[model samples]
Target: MNVTLRQLRAFVALVRTGSFTAASRHLHVTQSALSGLIKELEHGLDVQLVERSTRRVQLSEIGEAFYPWAAKMLEDLDSALRAIADIKELQTGVVRIAAPQLMACTLLPDMVTAFTRQHGAIKVRLVDCAVEEVLDSVQRGEVDFGIGPERALTAETTARPLFDLPFVAIFPPDHPLARLNRVTWKDALAYPMISLRGEYTRRLSADLQAVHPELMLEPVHEVAFMTTAISMVKAGQGITTALPYGLSIIEQGQLEARVLDGPRISRRFHIFARKNRVLSPAAAGFCDFLVQACLKQDWVRLPEAVSR
Candidate 1:
């Protein structure tokens, strides 16, 4: 029937304490206010919930039957509210993010590890997909946001530039290019280049081409993944180029990495999210954390880490 929470609270307090004075004192409300709430509850429910006397307070038969349900309803509501508060405070929740395969393996894992170290209660999910798929996932609202190269966003999306990572050449220790502290496009082209048959190679070709129209990068081998290209390079197949964000992986492969010069091009990393939507606390916190973390990255610095 239209019973109010305050009325239910007054009824329960009076029944538990067995004294109007004690119930009112427990509720920190005036005795008359407490009595009126119980009366409203009874009127609203059309039942005599309590028998009030100057000496004692007692629940009627129907009131005793409803007590458990009323108490449970209040308890559940309080629990739900507490859960919402916890999510808002970042004490609990999950953050879903989409990233290109390279970043998912390298930069994203580092950022996730750093974030979770501080906010252990929050779980982070990374969807490692192709470059186009990263944008598609974000556009479809499949994840909280996407992190990848800057691209033309749909009207519904927005992007914030996180950092720019320069291209670095990686090769076997004894490779000729490895002898140079810094290599140029011509220096790398002198050797057979092993490259990924992916967006990165395509983007690099376009960027370098813009600087010199006739420049040609004929790879001795093109593979579908960076790791494959890296393996080939480790076998002394040829040198390959990639952004320095994941230099650690190159090091693990026993390959020497050096900054690439000539045109001094770099790829810009951006954080993508829906334009009009609000990010949950965890997602927003992650965006901030990622930006800060990238700023601290040695490779993200320009003119110092690499030629450009």
Candidate 2:
């Protein structure tokens, strides 16, 4: 009824090498010790597993039948142990993340590049979608985590604040607003604005209204994606407001990103993960690295209570 790994290893080695002396040499064990292990294995299994002669060692009928199974067991065990070691060393893993399109295009790429350089063995997969989709991805267990703005986290998901990206005005380089050191929300509202549709626009309006009730945001264009809004701004259609996180995209579109003041409005981005799920070591490591990288940025304000 009792079995041990040492006994199984000895049996398999004896079969492979075809001699107790050779098997002992391969295992770095005394021949007597190797023979004793085989005896113990045979006694425990209540079967004769080897036929021995002065000239050679061969597997008996029962041992021959079990050899394949024993070899397979050892192979599987070795693979499992190696995988564990790889995980511990951060030498193998996949870190899946879902993030808003704007962030995926801007803030995330730099973080990903830095992370992959330091951890060449670990792979990162990013799914760029809407803010809502990012939340859904984490809640549905589709990603190791999500990075986006604050949301109504379900009981199945948790959010940890990463950083707050102040709302910034994105405008074409030659636009009059771009000439200022900083653009005020009031000044931003006066322009023909290109705005994001749905929740983002609503939140911007609501938050701005709470602070400056007399203010109004009337957009000449409303788009589903930030890229579209950026496109509109680049064409000199109008200015748009977005978190500074997407500065790369704005810069790519030949637009300038200046912090919006007059009462700085910022959107807080969070790291979202399943409530009870344990992240892979690679994912956890990336999360820590991302927080530190974000903190180094001048515009990213980390909450005082946040931790690695």
Candidate 3:
């Protein structure tokens, strides 16, 4: 405890090679500095650590008993330091993310899997949030990043456009458009529609309005979330629209999904990171992986079932 790590290292090297010059070379230090460190350590412990003459040096009684202990202690300390370095250098730390429920189901699971494989020591936390909540969390510094549709974001945050997901029609198997591969917006117009209402905190209804301006999107059944909208479609009550590239649980559970070609209401998936904020090295690497993932255009491919 009274001695420094340098002192212990020098002592170990001197004993291992039984020569001051060899220990100095081993430690990359001058022989005089190494001699001072060894003497300082011996003086602190009040023990005769080394027997020295003009050209020869030998361990004393106390030094003989301590040689193995000092060497082992230094080795253990070095190993611990290397482990901590790996945790930081290898992108091993906790990262929190805010994602929309649809993305939590559609894209994030696979992304998380790949990320964890490469960085097994990193801890990841995923929050199933609305698009507006995701934006708020990222801006407020509660989350490292957010993934959702691109909307009006503050200038402090930088967003990368990931992909464009077109609208898909959701209907029961017995519905008229169920048999079609791709149904036009006019096809949906013929029937009453159900939709997620009050899903976004912002006053702007960006997705629907951006797609259909001239025609009214008569929401016969207004629900609070995507799950509710899917429920309505399953009940044979009315049909709704979803992201063509993204899959809903309703696709496998109770309803059919058809791509809509005419209205072509697609959205830009954006990855949000606060601008000018210093990110931890691990978080920055994770963001890089996210960007590479976005460019690959592989998020839309869904497996047969949800692995949640």
Candidate 4:
């Protein structure tokens, strides 16, 4: 109805504190004022929110269900107001991102960390899922943007190449390919392998076939995740190839890798946002940070001079 923010705030205070006196203390209002606000809210909503007996106060069933939602409404309202205030003060609002799972695991944590350290007030929520899921979420305006292999963006979405991720091979330290700085595509095919069981994997196989048109590769097993495929290779199940950071994940001490010599097989890691999505200031800050971070890593990881 016509309930005001102040009234809602007062109701939340009493609901949280469980008594008018305590709520009055916390709200810095007289007990009578807090009690009056509750009465006004009941009149507006035509329901009893608080049950009053001498010993204590309790929320009616409707009040119990309504309190959390009311609190969230107030919280969201406050966040929006604060974000607007920040804009005037040169700060951005929160940014919610849904990133591809493997990239989220290896890359996003660092991006979020550095961004938070730089902009203390900007809020960031990063959700991790597969490429298809990321695309769907962004399309639905559930996230500000996504990073991974760019699938075809829907008409309502926009995407751009952020970077290229070369497919690198991972083998145990003593494996045959380990001694070589780079091994040819045909050389890689000769080894038993584990690989992702998705479009990316098909692309890799096709890329291999480009160099060896007659060649065919059937992995030991197809997996749903890049990390899992990498793990399989590291456990010595067989050798495998993955996006560059898939190799970086190895450096975390659970695996190892080397550049695969081929026709430069790599996937485009792209930045995607819904065509008409409204991004909060915080989200926009994160988007900029992610692009910059990936660019820096690209510079740093461009096949070391020794390997080239």
* Whole-model Cα lDDT of every candidate shown, in order: 0.83, 0.84, 0.75, 0.76
For candidate 3, give the lDDT.
0.75
Top model number, lDDT? 2
lDDT of 1 at 17: 85
Candidate 1 TM-score versus the reference = 0.90
Instruction: Compute the lDDT of residue 268 as modeled in candidate 4.
Output: 80
What's the TM for model 2?
0.86
Clashing residue pairs for model 4: 93-281, 93-282, 95-283
Once fitted onto the true fold, the runs of candidate 2 whose alpha carbons sit more than 4 angstroms away are 15-36, 52-58, 301-308
List the candidate 1 regions with Cα displacement exceeding 4 Å: 302-308
Off by over 4 Å in 4: 1-82, 88-92, 251-254, 298-301, 304-308
Which candidate number would show the highest TM-score if scored against the true structure?
1
- The candidate, 1 or 3, that scores higher on lDDT is 1
Clashing pairs in 1: none
For 1-308, candidate 4 gives per-residue lDDT tens digits of: 77877788999998788788899999999999988998898888899888886468788999898899889999999998886888644365567788877878887788788988888777778888876688888887777887768577678888867777666777777788766767776777789888777776777777778787876778888888878877777787888876666454765445556666656666787778887776566666677777778778853358432142
Worst 10 residues of 4 by lDDT: 299-308
Model with the higher lDDT, candidate 2 or 4: 2
How are the candidates ranked when ordered by TM-score, highest leading?
Answer: 1, 2, 3, 4
> Over 4 Å off in model 3, which ranges?
1-19, 29-84, 199-213, 251-253, 294-308
lDDT ranking of the models = 2, 1, 4, 3
